[model samples]
Target chain A: MAGIPKPKLNAGQRKSQRGTEEAPFVKWLLITVALLFSLVFLLLPLVNVFAQAFAKGFTVYWDALKHPDTIAAMKLTLLVTVICMPLNVLFGLAAAWAITKFEFRGKSLLVTLIDLPFSVSPVVAGLMFVVLFGLQGYFGEWLADREIRIIFAVPGIVLATLFVTFPFVARELIPIMQAAGSDQEQSALTLGANGWQTFWYVTLPSVKMGLLYGTILCIARCVGEFGAVSVVSGHITGKTDTVPLHVEKLYNEYQGAAAFAVASILALGALLTLGLKTWLEWREAKLETLAQQAEQAITQ
Target chain B: MSIELKNITKQFGGVSAVNDVSFTVADGQLVALLGPSGCGKTTVLRMISGLEMPTAGEILVRGKRVNDVPVQKRNIGFVFQGYALFKSMSVADNIAFGLLIKKWAKADRDARVAELIELLGLKDLAKRFPHQLSGGQRQRVALARALAPKPDVLLLDEPFAAVDAKIRQELREMLVNLHHELNVTTIFVTHDQEEAMEVSNRIVVFDKGRLAQIGTPREVYEEPASEFVARFIGVMNVLDCEVREGVARCGELEFPTHGVADGQRLRIGFRPYAVQVSNDLMAYRHFAVLRHTYFLGVLLRLELEFPSGLIIRARMSKEEYARLNLTEGRKISLQIRQYRVLAREGELLPPEVSVTHHLGPSPGDGI
Candidate 1:
């Protein structure tokens, strides 16, 4: 401490200090704009739907819950989300691992292909799957000949949901995996850990939180999917209609109350997702603190 | 425990980072690969630890060829300069990483982790995360992690570079004691000559992807094979000289020569502390102080100006300074406590120059 003297700030340094003081204000301004946009565009609509759904007291809630069509749509949406979320997570992990952890020709092109669905219209995504597996599409003829239904059926709805939500997990995971670097994996290899052990003990643990967060987002997207599911589902009552599609069908039939009731259920899922996001952020912070302390103890 | 690197060469897109560098580390001996930045000291360590494979040549551990062996199979412990502790694990878990990898029983792993926790003085902080610890503590965890496996060879890459100066000293002492107590073959890479000298039993001086010199710390310091080694291991004053009649003449002074014929031109070197200063320039020996006195705790260093205007440093103890009453603008006598006569074709001296001189108090002289 005595060897090196701290220099006093000059006029330029003082000006830079003033700039630093104003930086937080600029950051806060941007955050306020984002929060305002979400409140107006998202939270407001959700609140309106919930207020309408509860306006008739417990009668409307029980009536919607008892409706056969409403229950069927809810059940189908939950089933699709349950099936699609894990599939997307697996696909995302594989795609991210391939793009980031391995070297191959056209890797950039492959990444672009994985992200194609994000830029494509959801209706187009559904049509692309329809062309590949619909009754008159490529594999549709063979499937129909075998009496195996795809389009306008439950499987078709699930496939369309899968396509629309394809990139969610991989999109979240690739950057995190790349940022984590291969140092941990290399360290594990040097420690005599076989490939599987290295993955389970080191690589997987490092990316587990990222994987879970991405999976949650995937589930949210899968449950709320409408455009793609509508294109392939054919709106079969008590069968292929999902919750979002069911809401649209009810709204068109002049059943505004039932529409609002079903919309409220999906809205509840959005709230749950927000809660999951917050929990994931807290876990990330906790992990970071643990990492810092481990570093300190090691160096000490 | 001896390690041998035979003609090991690593090239990156037409540039050879390490070129045909060969050396051996005997069992239980600590060797430092000393060099300037980009001299491939770290590359050599990485190759030895199996972090990077040599593009050409073979690596043998204890006389067994292991060029293609995977890093983990090599059983070598590596401590990165940044101390790469797993951010997700606690101090105890980080140390147990290798033990867990080895599939040691839970009881054994726990016991080993506890032993290391105590050994590293982290028993109280075992549950702590890496971020909560200081720089020195992180370094200890990295060391403990590397040592937990009881590796065959330990490789450290600039281990103390990240720590504060105060902690660096403590870590250096800890490393010296650890090396002795563990008796593992250790290769430490550092650009700091003082650290290398204090921590290593032997030094391998590297320059431009080549082995400049390799010897014990005393050998390298006393008889540096080249000017690079001389300037690198410690402070030195290399003066241009001419050898004649078993003596090397530098400016106005002549000193006894080594390994060169008369009339051959060469370079002469001496340690700063070997030079003596006096008020009466002509009354003393064949040396002269140039200008300015520098205070280096316990010693006074004077920049001496030869007749040719070349500058050299001279160091004297405080008691010597008190007795002599040395000050700025005062004349002084200089001598070499010890030095090396480098070969002409060697990296230090030009081929046209052929002799060198080392002068100092003769053997048995207390001063």
Candidate 2:
């Protein structure tokens, strides 16, 4: 038998034969385009907000932060978050548990309804509350008879914000809970744990990471919401205005420094959320690696 | 009876999952619900454990009807198919979960967990989370957890289905030993016939949501009441033949009609071990050429091809194969020593010939 001689090639041909990657020039061109795209659309706007806020002297920026209206807006924002976070978390947990852990009629439709907020326009969400609670809306006469106000007030602002951010936590939890399955809960039940005990000890702990991730996202979204809160706030500065609505009011009144300064706070909140998400991903990966090492040690 | 299921039927969205299934497990006996996947064996186990409700039946646990009882209150330990060990809890915590739920004192809970850890050989894994343990280790932990509460009855769903073959064999032996030591009324579901036969004292076979047979392993293996059981339990060569004159003829193979009407179609099944092969072509009345040989460790499976395009599986020892110089494509003579007339699909078996009958050559029949 004759031995087949190996083929020889130059460096250029050898590189082409190594993999299915594009040519060097094409690869670099694509990377350059993507980097420039992010720079223009993402990095530029963020840098501009901080840059414009500090363009004035430090005293001006500090004064903008110290303004009574800005303080009220910050407080209102925090108040809305405090009121909405727990409600949303409880609702999200219930919704996700029902959808993932059991089979019933209209389950897929319920999942779609939970995601309705994400797809519906924020202004429409605001209008939905207005139509329900406004003076001319249904149950409006009964509410007016009781002298309770909802639309065009702080309560209205909270309601609109809740509608817009309703799906965040539930969306994050559904896939996590679905993937983990109902087996552990069933196992807990078979071990003499009642329904509540199974949920607390087995289901909740398994999905805590996803729940935390979702809470961070929901808080970030709730704090930064604009269109819905603005529609329902009636531009009542120092009373009903959240951080986003107040920022818009400041910019509209030619208070550019104050608006940019207020905007930077929300930007920082987003940065912190991103950092927390990264930390969670890192910790989860590290835990997975440790588990793998333990398993390998057993085999060894 | 320790547990009795009477006329148990389960329907999912109008489709029957289990239909008219009835069985009883004596106290301190290990029984296996054996069937293929989607055969409702797992559903039967779940209904017994009170995790699933039977659509129309009565489940009696130690002579008490428990149809409406919740799973937690049923006091039945259930091991899920996937083990389902709490990923967030350590092995000791998982085993102690049941004991704590029962309001046992901390000391007693710890003592029980320690005893189970020692019994299941999980001493070092007590502190490790479920993710850190191996598949076989996780299974042992699940078993220990289910057993920790000292429930009167224990049910397992495909307990060894997830492990590798070698570990599966080891786990089967461990379960047998554990059952012997703890003498609890145990019922386990498995699709592996060998596991069911090796682990349980009694086997209840299922076919398409109905109870096909319930008997000892030997009875089910030797005298399968239906055609499905005969094929599902082990390797059996089933042939469709028509009786002509005094014999049932299937291509080149013939069996005694066993009192069947002439020209009537009959089904006969014979085990591979019943196939007797001789090196001399004239030794037996029938001849076939060896086509393929499969090695199954100690036993050799031979596929023999007759002239009429019929193939039959035969098993022989390695020593006999070597002594007779049997190889593929070699001609050999074979005879079927025993076979049974299998009941047709959905038909009841005739009591007389349901058991296999031995046949000898007829007198004055020239070879």
Q: How well does candidate 2 score on lDDT at residue B114?
A: 95
Best by DockQ: 2
Give the TM-score of each candidate.
0.84, 0.91
The TM-score obtained for chain B by all candidates, in the order given, is: 0.87, 0.92
What is the interface RMSD, in angstroms, for predicted model 2?
0.9
Docking class of 2: high
Residue ranges of candidate 2 with Cα displaced over 4 Å = A1-10, A13-19, A293-300, B280-284, B307-309, B322-332, B344-367
Location of the lowest summed lDDT over 10 successive residues in candidate 1 chain B: B358-367
Find the 10 residues in a row with the least total lDDT in model 2 chain B. B358-367
Expressed as tens digits, the lDDT of each residue in B1-367 for candidate 2 is: 2999999999999999999999999999999999989999999999999889999989998889999999888888899989999999999999999998999999999999999999999988899999888899999999999999998898999999999989999999999999999999999999988888889999999998999999999999899988788877877777777788968788789999667778777778898889999999889999999998888777888888888878888888899999999989999999999998885323634422223232121111110
What is the per-residue lDDT of model 2 for residues A88-135, given as tens digits with 9 covering 90 to 100?
Answer: 999999999999988899999999999999898998888888788888
Best by TM-score: 2
